[model samples]
Target chain A: MKTEDLKNTQDYKYGFTTNIENIRAPKGLNEETIKFISNIKKEPEWMLDWRLKAFKRLQVLKEPNWQKPKYPNINYQDLYYYSAPKSTSEKPKSLEEIDPKILETYKKLGIPLVEQKRLNGIAVDAVFDSVSVATTFKDELTKQGIIFCSISEAIQKHPELVKKYLGSVIPLSDHYFATLNSAVFTDGSFVYIPPNTKCPMELSTYFRINASETGQFERTLIIADKGSYVSYLEGCTAPMRDENQLHAANVELIALDDAEIKYSTVQNWYPGDEKGVGGIYNFVTKRGACRGKNSKISWTQVETGSAITWKYPSCILQGDNSVGEFYSIAITNNFQKADTGTKMIHLGKNTKSKIISKGISAGNADNMYRGLVDIKNKAINSRNYTQCDSLLMGNKCGAHTIPYIKNNNSTSIIEHEATTTKINEEQLYYCNQRGLDQEEAVSLIVNGFCKEVLQQLPMEFAVEAQKLVAISLEGSVG
Target chain B: MLNIKNLETIIDNKHILKGLNLNIKPGEVHAIMGPNGSGKSTLANVLSGKNGYITKGDIQFNGERLNDISTEERAQKGIFLAFQYPLEIPGVNTNIFLKTSLNAVRKAKGEKELDTLTFLKLIKEKASELGIDEKFLSRQFNVGFSGGEKKKNEILQMKLLEPTLSILDETDSGLDIDALKIVADGVNSYKNKDNAFLIITHYQRLLDYIKPDFIHVLSNGKIVKTGDANLGLQLEKTGYTSLS
Candidate 1:
């Protein structure tokens, strides 16, 4: 097929908006908006205080400008800080009570909320437009002492757990978007695995931005107690709009002694049109803390959406002999821009971290991998290995790697490798001679390039991620 | 089964294959021997329909004009070129690559794709026939492979793909006597009366194993001489300078 024909065939499939009554706090950001959101959730006074403090910090914090891709000015007040489906007022007791339209929307996204139609061996928390619409397999999870519910419900039922772990990893004084997410964040999935119990099933959260001009500020927190293990997956999608929507989400994870948390994300939000008219501005802050000895936190993300994506899912290795891993495949097509990578902070002895990032850019898009590996003075005998690879599909696209390594201890071992490669005609011809067309050949080659990171995802997600990688690069090569 | 008439291929505005003409019938083994820059590899590339080359010729395969079709279409019609330097595609497993390639060819031929179990069995059989172990199937395609191993892998692909017209471009380069014999045996075993072979090489060592029906001497972008297999022996003894 001609390259031109292949171009723009990857229109966002999840761009249809669900028509539903919304109970929204008036468009804007202020102390009142935070208080209003907290009041709607019926939060305690301490939680309100936390939001007010985060709101104050956000006021003082300026939107960071030190990034690769530049965008038009964003007026924060023009965006509705909180917009929840009106059906969320009286929280549904089961899937039957939830609005059928919301359930149908989830079904369209390939995430059926019905217990029988849901994915086997996985519990899903469906969050739509700042509220948890339906969380499936709740009883099954609760039977195993696994508290899996919305963050709002978690705060109401187990405030001590939410208060103890919230803001512990990412404080209100964190980055600008993170501070904002802390202030008016409406709802997200909250998972807690008790001590000595491996979670019976995989926990997943499907986030959808439905309301127009509403910023999605969802906060997700997961805590795995000592000797426990949990594998969590998060997927996001949004409707296509001419005006770019804002999504600033914050995710925090804590793994206690001998615990492990495997977090996987497949982000497929609307990436705007061919002219880059409208899309999501995804600025997310996700971090995991290995707070106990021999703990492990592994992050596997396949980011292939948003017009402008600025995210770095990082890990803080604060326990002796703890291991942290970040495997990512970030693809930018058309006029999209992605500045994503990971940060590994080694603060304990014998800590180890591995980062394998693959970035693909096509069609005037720009993709960058900005990562930092910091081994503190107390992190004796720490080791880090990072490999960042970039593949540019067309001459008009750009791929950049900015790796920052700060090692205060001489006993630490750090190895960094980066490579920038373009789709070579020779390779394409070689593949063509073996009976594959240009698109198939490009997909195969790109999949090979990202095999290391793709292998890190779970079996089902790996397949989806591979297809997304191929679709994102369609028509990227001539 | 293959014919080239007045083939003139220019790459980068520099004439590479100038009015080269050749014809091969089914069950024929043809070897084109040449020195460096003699356009032997260019002939193979052009026959396989690689891009970036301007060609003015009548190249027909199976009664169809091939110049207008894409490289993959050419392959679907039974054209295979064993690269002189096999590309190292990291993370593409050798078995998967071979399976995909074979399935692509099969699909074009209106055949069903083989299941994973069937494919694994087929590859294991073919690989062991070429003295390759199962472990090589799981590794990245040609990544960090030794020269002999790469050449053997090319032969493996050629055997599994089972093309009607196979073009082995300098397959013996960088091979030891043992590896060369194995590769030659692979090609000889794969050759049958229904198919053809076009071998492009620098020396007569490969010809010693797989006898060629015709030996064409390529010099200065065209065929200078055509003779029997003994001609290769004579050229090995008396260089191209003597022929000129």
Candidate 2:
């Protein structure tokens, strides 16, 4: 089969739009727009002050250009900073009371909002566009002293908890995109696991982008108290459009003494067409801080969408004997571009971190892995190991790895290894000779390439992520 | 049955096989012996439909022309080639690879695919029969396997696939006396009246274990002589230089 024939057979399955009235903020980014977003959410005075400060900082910040992916200038003022479905104003008391169209949208996305039809034992906080539509299993979570809700409601119901840890890990002046998100962020999920308590079930959030010409800036904050444990999963998707959309999200995690947090994400935003006309520009900042002794944090993500992706979920190991781990599989196909990795900073004694990253690029896409490992002067006896692998399917695609390691402590050890490989024609011929077709052969080989990273994902997400990996690489080889 | 007439194969603008002809009927085993650069592997590649080979021939397999068919289609049609140097595919378990190949061939033949339980049972039995450790089934395909183990793996695949015409390319190379017997026994157990074997080797040691009905001397892309099993012993006494 020809490459063009294989390309023609692939179509985005979640490209359909949901028609609903949207209450959008005035198009543009400025102090007034930030105020408008805060006022709509009825945020507290201190929260408004924080957004104002972040907006002020964002004004002087410039978007970093030292990455592998290149794109045209982004006109920040041309994008609507905030947009929400009209039904969000009147909070629905039950799933049936919610707008059927919105319910149907989630249903079509395979994330049914109806409690009975949804995956049992998993609590969901569904965020549509810029607002939270519904949060299920809240009563049960409350019974177990676990607080899981949208960030907006968390600010209203648990203001003290929200204010204590909101930018503690990732400050408002962290970076360009993060500062922007902090200023104009609308809604995201928030979880607070109490001390010495193990969460009863997996906490999940489904994010959807339906409104056009809007930028989704969500702020997620998760706090695991001392001796607590929690696992969180996030999934996102956007509608197909002729104009590129922007998604700048900020996620912060805090693990206290003896606490552990596991965060997993499967992002499938709309990638531009084969001609590279329209898609989502995903620039996200996700960071976690192990603030107390013996705390741990693990981040597992499978990124397979967006026209341009710039993300590095990082960890700051501040507690003695703490551990940080990162496992990622980022696949780019067609006109997509992704530059993602992780950063591990050891600030305490006897800290350990491990990084595993797999990148697959096909079609005309470009994928890069840029990671950093820093062992501070106080981090004696610390150890870090990093492995990054890249697989290029077609000649036109590109894969790059840039790793930076700095060890200030004499007793610290850091090791970094990287490899770039192409799919072997001999291997493909061998598979073909065993009665497997071209696509099946490619899928099998690519799956083998990404087996390490895929094994890190949760059970349900692992299966979906494997399928996404195969779908993203369709028509990449001839 | 397999037939080839005026078979010529050119790779990278170099003619590797010039006017090669051969015919093998069912229930028969044929051994092709020659020195280095004798186009033994090229014939196996062309017969299995590998790329980068331009051919001028009328090759018929089971009464159907084989040139136009794809590699997978040819395999589905019951043609198997045991590679001289089987590629190691890391992260693909041996059991999974064999099961997928078996199911693909079965599905193409209009047979029900084997479930995990049935496939495991079949593969374990085959592995034990071939003297392969049960632990080898869980490892990556051919990765970290010794040369003898890799050859055993190829024969294990042939047993599971149950192809009508099996071509063993250099199956005897890099094997100890014990390893050679295990591989030969694997082939002997799978042999039947409905299937045929084509063994390509550089030595007569392999033929001593699995006797061939006919021995063809392949030299410079074409067969120079044809004889019975005694011909293999004669060539062992006098190398290809004497035959040429």
Candidate 3:
């Protein structure tokens, strides 16, 4: 990396530009570019064809007409389809060879990657700018028959596994963003825990989009085999930029018979400047499939940063006795916009699902919760419950909820409830009278409001996620 | 320890507390008795720095003009109000909330933060003294607690916070005899030579447990008359009709 690049990256606490070299393709997306990404990763022929097919479908797919997020016209031809870190002159035999600026960035973000050994039983895969830079605790995970690494590496090493389940639930034509992500996604994590293996450690990935003007399109997939259980954590941050960069990622999970997967995301991407000049436009598609009997999948996300975020990580229960759950806390401040929620589809006998969503809006931001619950005719005795609540910190901000439930079976019991409210000045006064400052009281109250979802995170990530929420909404209150 | 002279307050242009005047000296406990809609709670709220109330006149806490100070500032200056209906804060452990409030007060007083062991020991001792079980400390603050339990919880907070000028805003309204006694005993134990209390109540039942030095009849948002503790017994027997 050039000296100027390193200088630019260190300016942000999360984005530390790298100096190492990388193989780069020009910035643009097309069928050939998609083919280039697949060929460069040396993926199987079937996977390459899949990418191409998804690419063609993407061109024909129309932008979604749901919800009220103002997404600008994205020029696919102008976005860089692929990016990755430059390989080292010599493989990093020690931490000394790692870029100090990048490590310093993570340290400032409170995620010091160099202290992996001290993290204790948790594996970390750190992705910088469009590529997986370093993966730790791989040896330990490998001992337990678990694959924890980048999807690109997984495609090369575990082609059959990736091919068998990629896009199985969120197919190429599932939605506009999902199709676009499927076509030109660059890199994300892939994990598979074999049958009956209780994952010995929590798995995590720290993603940083550091490069300027480069759109990031990453994809992640996790699979838990029969009777297996795994918990995964994701964290994101970006550098300050003058123009809004697009980030459209896709994540898919598959749980086999009696398996369970718990996924958590703490997103604190760089919001625009205080005046709302520029930021990242985060659009993502994440879905899971409960394929085997009694399988379960749960998603918990704390969203605090993004110029505009449009995502609804969902679950499809296609097996008997399967379960799905979504717990989320989405907060926006300073002219940001977020439209996020979840969908649960029950298609099998005795399937069950629960959704709990909390949205907080402040500083002229607009936040919305859009969720769906669908029960098919074959879903006998299915149970679905959804509760969505929104808190507006100031009169200048906006919070809205749009929930849709389609039940085809009277045997199923689906309950939906939602409410919208503003943070009462009296509550703040009460807290302050107990000796809390304005910001501290707001943080305490908001955390209290989202405790249901924050508690769902693994113990380690829960603390990190809490700090992320505090940092994201630091200046949101009076 | 606290003084308010000709204090007037309005909410949304409606005068709620009109020229209310009362004085509380250190080592004294004054009970302000009133009927419903007499602005008993409004007086407590205005004194505690709750926003959205237009105010006139002045309040002095330990000689500091308190009209411009924030609620937390007043709390730091040793004012605690036991709410009539304590707000339920779900997901916040009772101990954590107590400790945070305590530490905030201590920090404002230029004191060091208490160690976890010391804090826990203090909590255990006080919780037992107030008849609060160990389990209550681990649960969310006042969540799912019965009305009497909620009042007791407020007293528990007052005990832990140990403010110099503690205001009990109808702290006896929902309490049973036993709970009321427990709450009054907690308040009585915290009283000292340099501390004062402003206990607002509609009934005189709590006075049997915690003795008051003076009683004031509040009507139409003003203190109409002031007398000794015998006045409380007389008012309870005669009702506010005679006082009005």
The candidate, 2 or 3, that scores higher on DockQ is 2
lDDT of each: 0.92, 0.92, 0.84
Per-residue lDDT of model 3, residues B75-138, tens digit only: 9989999988788776778887888888989999999989778999999999899888899889
Worst 10 residues of 1 chain A by lDDT: A2-11
Ranked by lDDT, the better of candidates 2 and 3 is 2
Worst 10 residues of 1 chain B by lDDT: B87-96
What's the true lDDT of residue A304 in model 3? 81
Chain B TM, cand. 1: 0.98
Please state the interface RMSD for every predicted structure, separated by commas. 0.7, 0.6, 1.1
Per-residue lDDT of A435-476 in model 1, one digit per residue for the tens? 998888999999999999899887867888888888877777
| Tens digit of per-residue lDDT, candidate 3, span A210-252 | 7766778889999999999999999999877768888889999
Q: Name the weakest run of 10 consecutive residues (lDDT summed) in model 3 chain A.
A: A6-15
* Pairs with steric clashes in candidate 3: A1-A19, A21-A86, A22-A86
Q: What's the candidate order when arranged by decreasing DockQ?
A: 2, 1, 3
Q: Please provide the root mean square deviation of candidate 1 (C-alpha atoms, Å).
A: 1.9
Output the TM-score of candidate 1: 0.96
Error of 3 at B180 (Å): 2.4
At residue B228, give the lDDT of candidate 1: 98
Tens digit of lDDT per residue, candidate 2, span A52-135? Answer: 999999889999999888889999999999999898786677877889999899989888566774456788899999998999
